[model samples]
Target: MEKKTNAEVQVNMHEEMRRAFSLLSGKWKLEIMWLLNQRLYRFGELRKEIPGITQHMLTAQLRELEADGLVLRTVFAEVPPRVEYEITQKARGLGPTMEALTAWWSEYGQSVPEKPSMRGRKAKAASSKLG
Candidate 1:
């Protein structure tokens, strides 16, 4: 077997990290996964759970996750068609890593100052312009 040089190893690692991020990166994807980590949710339920997410955005994000094999979407035929979303085993495998990341954020976020409110900033700007 040929030994990989340090540069080769670094390149491989970088590619792997990129792939992982590509699978998980998005405004709503991680939040969707976090919710599904608890239990299966109906489309409407998920929308309610995630505030400010549009129905269209949720559908798109869920489709992306389903395509990536992180989330499973099931449809049931009935009087009223029902659909549910749940994290796949592949995603469950990420539970520990997600937990660690969440824990780190909990600690780190406390030490960090709160971000300025975008809504407040926008209102202030508008008032300044009017004034």
Candidate 2:
């Protein structure tokens, strides 16, 4: 068997990164995962925990997470159906990575310059046009 070239290894790594991002992308997926990591939550509970997320969006994000094998959804058989969401073992494995990112963000975020506001940029552009 031939050893993989550096270019081939880089390409493979890039593809894997893309796949990882696809699973974790979107505004609420990471937040939802963070919450679920703490403990199991019902659909309504999750919605309440994540302020400003619509029920439709929460459901959609949970479904995507479930499909990705990072989250497990359990439905209980009873008079009133009880559904709960929990992070899977695969997702639990990401705990260390998440912790490292949080630590890095605390240090890195302070060093980064604040982004200029879009409204400020637009006002500057308008003033320049008027001049």
Candidate 3:
């Protein structure tokens, strides 16, 4: 086997990074995945959980995730019918990435200076949508 040239390796890395970023490019997709990691949720619940997210955007994001195989959508057959979305095993594999992000935020938060003028702390962003 032969090693690839540095230029070829760099190109491959760039392409790989682009592909990964493209998958999570949407504003709320990462939030949705993080929420689903905690527990499964229905459509209505998801909408209520994600602040500033319109029903139209939520629906579109969920469908996109489902198509990408990151979100698992299950629909029950009944009179009214029920649908729920959960993170698939593939999505669950993102746990380390999420944990690292949380860790980084913790360190970053600590680096901020405390000032009386700052007032109250910032609020948590709305929980990610489940479905």
Candidate 4:
């Protein structure tokens, strides 16, 4: 049996952690990655799923992930044309890590109160006063 030397193990561990952080350390990368994990989505579909993400930001983020070799972008030729994005094998490998994070979120998400939405509150108040 062969064993990894201490230095080799440390280097491997450091690289793995660095890769994880590089892929996930961003405002929308994790969110986008998780969504992509579910299934490939067209540009518009992704935009709809991630509310509050402007088109410009989403496009920029997707381009960055594509450049990092974590995402696959496919374009189809048609009358209107079609484009889709999906996680590459490298990104899909993060499935377990993402799933664990998702599990943690499910367990604690409900206990956390989301920020108040002024637009939502105002609409509710207006409707109540009208009725």
Best by TM-score: 1
Q: Evaluated with lDDT, which candidate comes out highest? A: 1
lDDT of 2 by residue, 29-92 (tens): 9999988888999999998888777788899999999999999999999769999999999999
Judged by whole-model lDDT over C-alpha atoms, candidate 4 comes out at 0.84
Clashing residue pairs, backbone N/CA/C < 3 A, model 4: none
RMSD of each: 6.7, 9.8, 9.2, 6.5
Models 1 onward score TM values of: 0.77, 0.73, 0.74, 0.73
CA lDDT, every prediction?
Answer: 0.87, 0.86, 0.86, 0.84
lDDT of 3 by residue, 10-129 (tens): 658778899888888897898898899889999889877877787788999999999998999999997799999999999899889988998998989788877653322344779888
> Over the stretch 1-57, how does candidate 1's per-residue lDDT look in tens digits?
999888766668777899999998987888899889989999999988887777888
Q: Give the Cα error of residue 66 in candidate 3, in Å.
A: 0.7
What's the distance in Å from true for residue 103, model 1?
Answer: 1.7
Q: 63, model 3: CA deviation in Å?
A: 0.7
What is the alpha-carbon lDDT of model 2 when measured against the actual structure?
Answer: 0.86
Q: What stretches of model 3 exceed 4 Å from their correct place?
A: 1-11, 110-131
Q: Which pairs clash in model 2?
A: none
Put the candidates in TM-score order, highest first. Answer: 1, 3, 4, 2
